[model samples]
Target: MERVHSDRSEQLYQLYKPLLFSLAYRMLGSVSDAEDIVQEAFLSWSERRPETVLNEKAYLCKMVTNRCVDRLRSPGKQREVYVGPWLPEPLITEALDSDSPSGAYLQKESLSTAYLLLLQQLSWVERAVFILREVLQYEYDEIAEIVDKSSSNCRQIFHRAKRSVSGLSGMADTVPLKSESLKALIEQFIHAVASGNTGQLMNLLKADVSMHSDGGGKVTAAVRPILGADRVIAFLMGIASKAPADMSFRIQMVNGNPGIVSYIGEQPSSVITFRMENDRIAEIYIVVNPDKLKHLPQR
Candidate 1:
C-alpha cells in the first residue's frame, strides 16, 4: 500500500512539476531557488497519504507558492549586501527559440527579461497574486488559497500589482522586431562599440535608454543605472575600452529573446539583453557576475 501511494504521488508530481516550477521561477526569479522549492514540495507530497489530498494540483501549487513567499520575505544572507545591480538570474529556455506562431507572443511575453524585472517591484504576496491571476489565469479563490489570503483581498492585491506594472508590462514586446532585425541591431551596436563610434551607437538607442549591470560586488560594474542615450553610450564605450584583447562576443537566445554573451577566454564574462521599442533599443541589462553565469551549460 505504501509503495502504491508513493508511486501515485510521484506520477502526480511529474504532471504538475512544470507548472509549479514556472510559478516558483516567476515568483522568485532564481532558477536554483525555484528548483529547490519544487523539490521540497515534491518531498512533502511523497510523505503524505494520497487520500488526504483533495486536489493534488492546488495542494502542490499552494505549497510552492507559500515556500516562495517565505524565501522572498527572508532572502538568502548572501543577498544582504549584493554588489552593484542585482538582475534576476538568466534562464535559458531553448524550447522558446522554436515557438510556433500561434503561441510565440504569449510565451515570449511571459518569460521575457523585461517582464521578469518588472515583477520584482511587487511585494511577495502581491507578486504571487498577480502572477497567478494575470499570467497563469488562476481564479481569485485559487490564488487566495495559494497565498493564504481571502478572495477579496487577493483581488485587491492583483489590481494593485497590475496598476503598478501596467506601463511597463509590454516594454519588451511592443516593438516585435524580427529576429533577423534584432540580430542585425545587436551586431551593429557591437561594431559601433568596438570602434568607439558614439554617433552610431546613439542612433541605435531610444532617447531615454538605460543600461543596468549586475556585478554582485564580485566584479566592477556601474553602481547605479546609466540613463539617456549619451550617458549609456559613454558607459558602454568605457567598458569596451577595458575589455581584454581575448574577450569575444556570441549571439545567444537569453530568456526567450535575443541576447549577447561575452566570453573572456572561454570563461563566461557577461550576458546582455536588449529591450526594443519604436525600432530602437529602450533598455539594456548586463549580468557580469561570475556567480550568476555559473549555471550556463558548457560549450
Candidate 2:
C-alpha cells in the first residue's frame, strides 16, 4: 500500500508539473524562481492528507499561484534594484514547447518578453488574476478560488488589468508572419549586420524600433534603451566592430520566436529576441546577464 501510494504521488506530479510551472513562470518572470515554486508546491502536496484534497488540479494551481504572488510581493525583490533595463530570463523554445496536457494555456504571445514586462506593470494580485482569466481561460469562480477573492472581485481585477495592458495586447493580436518568413528575415538581418550593409539593415527595422539590453551589471551593456532605426543600427554596428574575432551567431527559437544567440568560444555571451510589427523588427531584447544565461542549453 505504501508503494502504491508513492507511485500515485509520482503520477500526480508528472501530470501537473508543466501547468504549474507555466503559471508560476508567468507570474514571477524568472525561470529559476518559477521552477523553485513548482518544486516547493509538489513537496507541500506530498505532505497533505489525500482525502482532504477534493480537486487535485485546482488545489495544485492555487498552491503555485499563491506562492508566486508571495514571491512577487516580497520586499526588496531584485527587480527593484536590477542593473539597467531588466529583462526576464529567456525561456528557450524547447522548454516552452514541451509536451503537456495543459499546453493550450501557454499562448505564445503571453510568453513574449514584451507581454511579460507589461504584466509587471500590474499589481501582483492583478497579474495573477489576469493570467488566470486571460491566458489560462479559467472561469471567474475558478480564479476567485485560486486567488482567494470573490468572483465579482476577480472579474473587476481582470477588467482593470486588461485596460492597463490593452495597447500592447492589441499589438499582440496582429497575425504573425509564418515561421519560415521570420527565419528568412532573421537571416537577412544577420547578413546585413555581418557585412556592414546599413541600407539593408535600415529597411529591415521599423522607423521607431527600439533595442533593450540587460546585463544585470555583470557585463558591459547599454544602461538605457536605444531608440530609432538609425541609432539601433549604429549600436549594432558598434557591437559588431568591437566583438571578438571568435564570436559567432546562431539562430535559435527564443520565447517562441526565432532569435539570435551569440557565442564566444562555446560560452553564450548574449541571447537576442525580436518583436515584430508589420513584418519589421519593432523591438529587440538582448539578455547578456551571465546569471540569466546559465540555464540556456550548452552548445
Candidate 3:
C-alpha cells in the first residue's frame, strides 16, 4: 500500500470514519474497542504508501475486520477478569422514526431489547457472519476475504451463525408491530414505579413478570432473575435508590423500542429496555454497567 499524504489521509479518515466505526462497533460489541480498532486501521493505512494501496475501502475494512476478529478471540481474558457480570455497550438512537416500511433503519424486526439480548447468545464468528449477511449483506466471497477463510468455510460459518442468531432452522419474517397499547402500558407502569404507585403497577403487571439487571457487579443487583410483579418492583426501587443523586430519567427509542436512560450530570449512566406481550409489559432489563453505556453518547 502506498502512503497517503497528510492532507489526503485526513480526507480519507473523515470519509471512512463513520463506516469503519459502525463496522467495528457491530463486530466487536464494544464501542471503545471498535473506535480503537478503527484508529489502528487508519494508522496502518498511514504507514503504507498511497502508491502501495490498490483498494482503499476494501483494505481499510479488511484491516478493521481482522483486528476485530482477533479481539473477539482475545477477550476471554477480559471477560474472565471482568468484575461480576458484563453487558453489551448501550447505544441510544433516535426514536423508531417512520416505520412505514420505507425508512433506512432496518425495520426487519423492530430493534427491540429482546432482539439485542438474543444477540448476546451468538459466537463471535456467528455474530460477524450474521451481521455481514443480514445487516450489511456482503457476498460470501467478500466475507471470506475479510475473515481470511475459505469460501466454503465462510459459508458454513454463516449458516451456523444464521441458525444461532435466528434460533431457528429456517429464516423467519420478523416484522415488529408498534403496539400503542404496549407503549401505554409501559408508560403507565413507569409512572407507577417512579411515583411509587405500587397499586396501579401491580394491577397492570403479571403474576410472574421477570426482571433482569446487568449490573456488572459494579453496583449491587440480582445475579439471577427477580420473579413476580411484587419482587420486580422491589428490585427496581432498589435500583432507583442507587442511581446518581442528580440523575434524571427520560424515555427514548433504543434498539428500535421504548427504552429508558438515566443521565447523571447530563451523561447517560444506564439504559433499560422492556419486553411486552399482548399489550402488557412482560420483562424489564436494566443495564447500568458503565462499560456498556459508553456508546450512548450525548450528542
Candidate 4:
C-alpha cells in the first residue's frame, strides 16, 4: 500500500510540475528559485497522507504559491544592492511550430523581460494575486484558497494589481508578428550591429527606444538605462567597437522571442532580448550577469 501511494504521488508530481513551475516562476521572477519551490512542494506533498487531501492539484498549487509569497516577502538584500539594472534570467522557450496556436505566442510574451519587470513593480501579495487571476485565470475563490485570503480580498488585490500593470493588459489583444518575420528582424538588427551600419540600426529602433544592461557588478555594463534611439545606437556602437575579435553573436529564442546571445569562446557573455512595438524595437534588455547565465548551454 505504501509503495502504491508513492507511485501515485510521483505521477501527480509529474502531472503538475509544469503548472507549479509556471506559477512559482511568474510569482518570483527567478527560475532557480521557482524550481526550488516546486521541488520543496513535491517533497511536502509526498510526506502528507494522500487521503487527507481533497484535491491534489489545488493542494500542490497552494503549497507552491504560499512558498513563493513567503520568499518574496522575505528580506532579500541581493536585489537591493544589485549592480546596474536587474533583469530576469533569460528563459529559452520552445520554438513555435506551424500548428502552434496564438495563445501560445501570448503566453511566451508574458515571459518576456519587459513583462517580468512589470510584474516586479507589484507588492508580494499583489503579484501573487495578479498572476493567479490574470495569467492563470483562477477564480477569486480558488485564488483565495491558494493565498489564504478571503475571496473578496483576493478580488480587490487582483483589481489593484491589474491597475498597476495596466500597460501590459493589452498584450492579449495585440497580435504579435509571426515568428519568421521576428527572426528576420533580429537577424537584420544583428547584421547592422556587426557591420557598424548606424543608419540601419537607427531605422530599426523606435524614437524612444531604451536599452538596459545587467552585469550584476561582476562585469562591465551600463549603470543606468540608455534612453532614446540615438543614445542607444551610440552605446551599441561603442560596445561593438570594443568587442573582442573572437566574440560572436548567435540568434536564439529567448523568453519566447528572437534574441541574440554573445559568446566569448564557448561561454555565453550576454543574452539580449528585444521588445517590439509597431514593428520597431522599443526596448532592449542585455543580461551579462554570470549568475543568471549559468543555466544556458555552453557553446
Candidate 5:
C-alpha cells in the first residue's frame, strides 16, 4: 500500500538522519548547506526500496559525503574577496550533552572553529579521508568505498593529511575548557574592558595572541588579523570604548565551544570564540557577518 511504503520510508529516514547531518556538517562548515545535502540524500533514499539497504547507515553517510565533496569542488568564488578575516559559521551545540561519548568526540574533534579552518587546507579527498578515518574511526576499507579510492590509497592520503595538520590536530583530543571556567574568563574579560583595565586584559591574553574578526564587508570590522597581546588588547578596548550604551554580552555555545555573544537590542552584533594555550587565550575568532548569523536565534 502507498501508506505502508511512505511510513517505512519515514521510519528509515528518522533512524539515520542525525548521523548523516553530522557527517555533512563536518564536511562542510555551513549548517545550511549540510541540511540541504541531508535533505537531498533523503530524497534519493525515498526512491529506493528500504529492504534493499543492507547497511543504511553507511549508505546514507556516503551519499552525504559525496555531495559535500562535489559542493567543495563547485566553482564558488564568494570567499575569494570575503571581507576581513574569514571564519566558519558558528554552530551552537549547547543542547548536546558533552558527557556522552559521541558528544565528547564531536566537541573535541570536528566542531571547533579552529579545526574547521584547518580542514580547509586539505584537498576534498584528503579532508574526507582524514575526517572519516581519524575522527570517525572508519575502517580504511570502509573509507575507501565511501571515497571511491582503494584502501591502500586511502591509507596514504590519511597519513599525508595527518602530517599536513599535525600541529593543529592535537586540539581534537584535548578537552574544551570547562563551562564554568570559560564563563569566568569571559566575565573577567568583559569587566577588564568595561573598566578600561589594560593590565588585567593583557594578563588574560597570551603574548602571541591573535584576533580575527569576520564582518563579511557588510559592517565595520578590522581588515586583517591583530597580532600580539598589546595590539589585540588595544583593539578590544577601542571597540569597548565605542560600544553602544545599550550593548550587552552573554555567554553562548559557539561551534561547540564557549563564546561571548554581543547584542544591540535584539540583533546579534558579534560572536567570539577562543583558542587557549597554556591556560591563556592564544587566539580569538569573532564573527559579525550578518549572513552567517541569520541561522542564530536573535535572542
Candidate 6:
C-alpha cells in the first residue's frame, strides 16, 4: 500500500509541475524564484507520508501557493541578495517557448518581459489570485482553496488585481517582429542610434513605449525605465555610441523577436530583446548583466 501510494503521489506531482511552475512564475516574475518555489513545494509533498494524503493536486498547489506567499511577505532576502539590475530570468524557447507543447507552436507574446515586470505591481495574494483566475482560468472556488481564502474574498482580490493589471495586459500579447521585418527595424534602430537620428527612432516607436535593461550592476545600464519614443530613442543611441567597436554584437531571435547578441572577444556579453507593438516598438529589454544570463539558453 505504501509503495502504491508513493507511485500515485509522484504521478500527481508530475502532472502538476508545469502548471504550478507557470503560476509561480506569473506570481513572482522571476524564473529562478518560481523554480525554487516549485521545487520546495514538491519537497514538502515528498516529506509527507503518501498514505496520509488526500487530494494530492490540491495539497501540492497549496504548498506552492504557501511558498510563494511566504516569499511575497518577506522579499527582502531575495531582493537584497540580488546583484546589479535584476531582470526576470529569461526562459529558452524550450521552456515557455511553445504555446502548445505537442503542437510546438511558438508563443508570440510569452517572451515579452514587459508583462512580468507589470505583474510586480500587485500584492502577493493579489498576484496569485489574478493569475489563477485570469491567466489559468481557475474558478473562484479553486483559487480560494489554493490560497486558503473564501471564494468571495478571492473574487474581491481578483477584481482589484484585474484593475491594476488590465492596462498592462495588452503588452502580454505583443508580437515579436518577424525575421525580415525585425531585421529591417533593427537596422533602422541601430543606424538611428549610430547617427543620433532621434527623429527616425521616434518614428519607429509607438505611443506609449517603455524600455528596461538588466545590467545587474555588473555592466552600466539604466537603473530606471525609459518611457516614450523620444526618450527611449535617446537612451538607445547613448548605449550604442558608448559600445566598444570590438564589443561587436550579432542579431538573433530572442523571445521570438529580433534581438542583439552582445559579444566581447567572441564570448556572449548580453542579449537585448525588443517587445514590438505594431509599427512602433513598445519595450526594449537588454540583459547584459552576465550573472542573470547564466540560465538563458543559446538561441
Clashing pairs for model 2 are none
Query: How many backbone clashes does every candidate have?
Result: 1, 0, 12, 0, 0, 4
Task: Sort by lDDT, best first.
Answer: 2, 4, 1, 5, 6, 3
Distance from true location, Cα of 138 in model 2, Å:
1.3
Among all candidates shown, the one with the greatest lDDT: 2
Query: Which residue segments of model 5 deviate by more than 4 Å?
Result: 51-53, 98-105, 168-176
35-115 in candidate 6: lDDT tens per residue?
Answer: 899888877776678767666666777788788878867857466565544666664443344545311323444435666
Show model 2 residue runs off by greater than 4 Å. 1-4, 95-107, 168-173
CA lDDT of each prediction against the hidden true structure: 0.82, 0.86, 0.69, 0.84, 0.82, 0.72
Q: Write the per-residue lDDT of candidate 5 for residues 1-299, one digit (tens) a residue.
A: 66777887798777766666667777788878888999999899878877878877678878898899888767772467666788887887776787754365556546778888898888888988998887778899888888888999999999999988877655555556776787789789889988999999988999989999998889888999999999998899899989999898888877777888888988888888988776678889988988878887786
> How far does residue 245 in candidate 2 sit from its true spot (Å)?
2.1
Candidates ranked by TM-score: 2, 4, 5, 1, 3, 6
The predicted structure with the larger TM-score, 1 or 4, is 4
Scored by TM-score, the top model is 2
TM-score of 1: 0.89
- TM-scores, one per candidate: 0.89, 0.93, 0.78, 0.91, 0.90, 0.78
lDDT of 3: 0.69
Question: After superposition, which runs of candidate 3 have C-alpha atoms over 4 Å from their true positions?
Answer: 1-4, 75-77, 95-113, 168-175, 179-185, 202-208, 240-247, 264-267, 294-299
Residue pairs in collision within model 4: none
All-Cα superposition RMSD per candidate: 3.0, 1.9, 4.3, 2.8, 2.5, 4.0
**How do the residues 1-299 of candidate 1 rate in per-residue lDDT, one tens digit apiece?**
99999889878876777778778888887878888999999998889888898878888999998898788767463455777777888876654524443233225566777888889878888888988888778999888777788999999998988988886565534757887899899999889999999999989999999899998888888888999998998888889899999999888777777788888888888889888998899999999888789888654
Cα TM-score of candidate 3: 0.78
